[model samples]
Target: MAKNHLLLSFSFFSVLIIAQISHIFAKNTSKSPIVIQPYIIDYRNGTVTKYYNGPASFVPPPIDSQVQSKDIVIPSPSYHNLRARVFLPARPDPSRKIPVLLYFHGGAFCIGSAFGWGDSHYVAKVAAEARVIAIAVDYRLYPDFTVPAPLEDAWAALEWVAAHASRAGPGHDPWVAQYGHLGRIFAGGDSSGATIAHNLAVRVGMGHGPHLSGLFLAMPYFLGSKRVPLEPKWFPFSPNYKVWPYVCNHCKGGVNNKFINPFGRGAPSIAHLGCKKLLVYTAEVDELRGRAIWYYKRVRTSRWPGQARWIEAKGQSHIFHISKPDDPATTKLIRDLSAFVNSN
Candidate 1:
């Protein structure tokens, strides 16, 4: 009886040890950071925190107020709030329909807010200058929600815009009803946002509707497992390298996933692009310049029945225009973009 008692005691002690070990293991694993730490690692620890301030709500002025802005709340199942800031030109003539620009901001897909001061101001300026109604999408970011989530939000925003294209009055966006030109919609973005725009174009090509007349990818971010010629030596080891898998939930195909790298081997051809025209902008000093040029070349030679054009900003870095809006190069960019949006 004593021996049996001893055995039970040993078993009980063993259980305690195992449980303690399990607890330690869980603690260590949980402590490892799961976020995009620049120049280091990008992992998902299932925690999400906003690093930027969300734009505050404000009452928009009338159409004649140079440019009007308003916040739109889009109901989402995955997110508590998915919103967009809509910018409308002042005094749009009701007799004429205005083009719509669905814009996404760039912050590596992990940062940035559509309502951010810079983004909001930029979109407003674009709307007033290009004479197009701009909808800057505020998508869910990493750690909280991963890849495909932002894309879903973007599509939802588009759908909502389409559904409310003609619905004006109480609770509806008046700018859209008053000035939105649904038939001349365009999708545009910068950096990772540009990547999302490309994916959206692809999905639209694959039969998703509300057809886009043009696609504008400014300082686009496109990548693959293989390094391109002239790629920065540090690129292969940079935190940007890990950004794709980290935000994409460590997708099975890695960088080859069509959504992450539109130029990947298995991705659908540029021929399948839904838009009739594509405008790609690149900065001379940007690391992603090579890939943008490569994309333009491929599209130009592809079977895609669309017109493609590329413009390179001399001695400029990625998204330089956004930061230095008063620069000559930025002015040129605005001019080029305005021409594209106003073109038939």
Candidate 2:
């Protein structure tokens, strides 16, 4: 029965992708068929076969000298293969408990993984620099599972991490239980993952879960009914404009859904953001930079009671540091992030 739903979703998503691609190719003068193979979905088996082909997914990097990582499952009979990848400092102070960071990887809400090469490496670097025990959540992606699904998975992971705070649990992750300082926890992500992070913090603030010390949003994926000046208006050309409505069954038919657009109609107020501090980054060339800047301003002006700040990566594109880990700005971003995590 679950497989049936999965197949249906893939079918629906495929149709949408084809429609957008068709619209894109309509304007091209060349007769060559562009082979933009992001992913292949087997409707018959309800499975997705991934390769190092597109922006959707990538092979993960191995553990480095700065931090070691391990993957562990969190039992979920409702969903298959629910898990998290934990990252910890290579050299730890045995006597001191470390801060906890719950991270989500972004792929426009459709694809990406905690185990993805860039995201995993970035998390490991953050863990090492900040001296925090980080858990990169592996949530179900779209065309298999959708908006509320990813959001629910994130909540479950947070609960699982928080559960480790008590020694009575049998499913506790050893490293998290032994070393994670739940009192100084943070949640963050990039792109769609940043959307998840924002929603999670809102949920927490509304008395839904454990408290978070800070929230980090890197190039958040937010869209609204009114189009931004820089963004193209022709909806069929950009799949992102349509992703929210398609993947999010509960979005009421548009991009204004709270999950995608935090300040949209019916969305929760920024005053209830539910964190001690917030850091938002926008790339200079990113189309969504304006929206990110708008969010930063909103948070600062809101009665959220948190210190909010914005950082713009001049001359960089969206999430550029992830792909270019060796960039000087990447090091600076990591160092600044580490300072944020470490600050009292």
Candidate 3:
């Protein structure tokens, strides 16, 4: 009877161990999946495929048929696939140098592409309407890469443009060589791209310069660990709550680092902003409007040696201009952007 009891006890313990192992496996598999694949991949054989499993769903055509556009792959030491899409005005005058705009696309630092349909269309329109040489940078995204990676790519693209504009030697982009005016350069973007633009401007302000004339921020994305008035109460606990830390893990101060939240407490003051002029466009209904407005107020009141202006599109939502470029409000915003870029 004692022998029988020992066998039964061993069997019970074995069953318990198996159940525990199964539970652990289920717990792990139940958690949300993290995506690590590239959103869009070019096979170097005239084929590009976009992975739809993640947020990056739109696959831009290889070429923008509406405007004179070309994709140039930037050689990078760290990242092998950095690229930029260059858009030229319909009537680019080789004799007259026009302003240049280095644009970044919005996708929460994770999803969008320079060659995405919306970005391509928007840059093409801006190039045609604003009569400026536009280059949309395709920076590395998150989960696979991280924050400073994108910033580094942006800086690299800017440098490349400056180099091409300064000297149109062999192997230079003809559009940039023919029309790009180095002195009147502008950096602009929407959403997270706007955030990158802001950070880039700040970096430039700290002694580096190709001399930015202006900055165009459309529905700029700025946030902190704490929630502010008019923002959702649960904002602090959202999925993106961890975004700053995840992307900026290398930052010394974590989420509160100057690069993550430039306007937050302890962050470098807006007085360090490099551009001579700042134009901020916000949609009234956008959840991020309040933050942009706050930034405008702070910059305007700060000792920054520049003019800061804000334009609110009533009843509009986040990134409305990019999604609805033909809308009257978007057209107005574009007109304002054109004027801002052309302004002295």
Candidate 4:
């Protein structure tokens, strides 16, 4: 009967619609070209929980019980009591001032924290094992506050570290004659953190910030786009880095300009303004390779170059070195960074 046919057609269409909806959800959930395991959920309530997708897990190495950890406040307009972590070297000699390294973390300025630095242990180990003091900053995130907020926090932290070095620890002051004058006060970070570090170097070298001794940029993302950052669905290769499901949330309903990205768009060039030594590292396979290379070239052509070095890692991706400890590439990076800090 015609009635029976109509009912059957409706049922078929309903099934089709359900299937399509399910498929779309699945695609969106795993749309990234490169899949990053060990997922995390950041809730509106300020709760952070990690979700592991693979058998591999985060097994932190043993810590030195003698090492001390403390928090120092950095001034920020966007947030009250902006803070940074100070990793004191074990067995500090009060008469000796240790070198300071201001480390910024990478999460595209949207997802990282000073406390959640997965590689904090590595740096702390270096600080303890290498006799250096590392200050890890928790800069502002996007949507809530953009561009200058992050940069401002970075500069403020550097200034605070320089001015309050003595307060953080006995003989921690970089300017004091005790610790060889804090040998080298360097700024460094991975990914977006690297981008900020590079920008700070340029700013400081140009007399915009307190004097800095060196710069270390790892896999920086220095570009901004009006269009959503996610690649076209037709692209074949997956970049291991996540594209942030809510990439547009921050840029939405706002005028696209340098305010959103000071390093992106048309910003003043700092290449010629750096006074201290600079080292830039990039992975060949990283999607951000082009931008990293561009920044490196800018450093060379800039007018205020003091000393610059660029190294391209073989068979590595963005943040890949830090994510995998057993990887030979990661080991080399740590050694090179330690050497740079020591020699510079």
* TM of each candidate vs. truth: 0.81, 0.82, 0.81, 0.68
Ranking by lDDT: 2, 1, 3, 4
Q: Count the backbone clashes (under 3 Å) in each candidate.
A: 1, 0, 0, 5
Off by over 4 Å in 3: 1-66, 77-79, 168-171
Worst 10 residues of 2 by lDDT: 34-43
Task: Note the residue pairs that clash in candidate 1.
Answer: 34-43
TM-score for candidate 2? 0.82
Tens-digit per-residue lDDT, 1-344, candidate 2? 99999999999999999999988787553534322134223223334333233564445546588887888888654557787888989878778999999898877766678887788778888888889998888888766676888888878877877787788585788788878888888999888888899999999988877888999998888888776555545643455554455468566737777778888878888899888999998888877777788888878888999888888888998888688777887888888788888887
Q: Which portions of model 4 show Cα errors greater than 4 Å?
A: 1-62, 65-67, 75-79, 165-183, 224-265
Q: After superposition, which runs of candidate 2 have C-alpha atoms over 4 Å from their true positions?
A: 1-61, 77-79, 228-237
Report every candidate's CA lDDT.
0.78, 0.79, 0.78, 0.63
lDDT of 1 at 83: 77
| Candidate 3 displacement at residue 222 in angstroms | 0.9
- Scored by lDDT, model 3 comes in at 0.78
Model 3 is weakest, by summed lDDT over 10 consecutive residues, at 35-44
Local accuracy of candidate 3 as per-residue lDDT tens digits, 202-253: 8888878456889999998788666666666766654444455555657766
Q: How many residue pairs of model 1 clash at the backbone?
A: 1
Candidate 3 lDDT at 212 equals 83
RMSD of each: 7.3, 12.1, 6.0, 7.0
Clashing pairs in 2: none
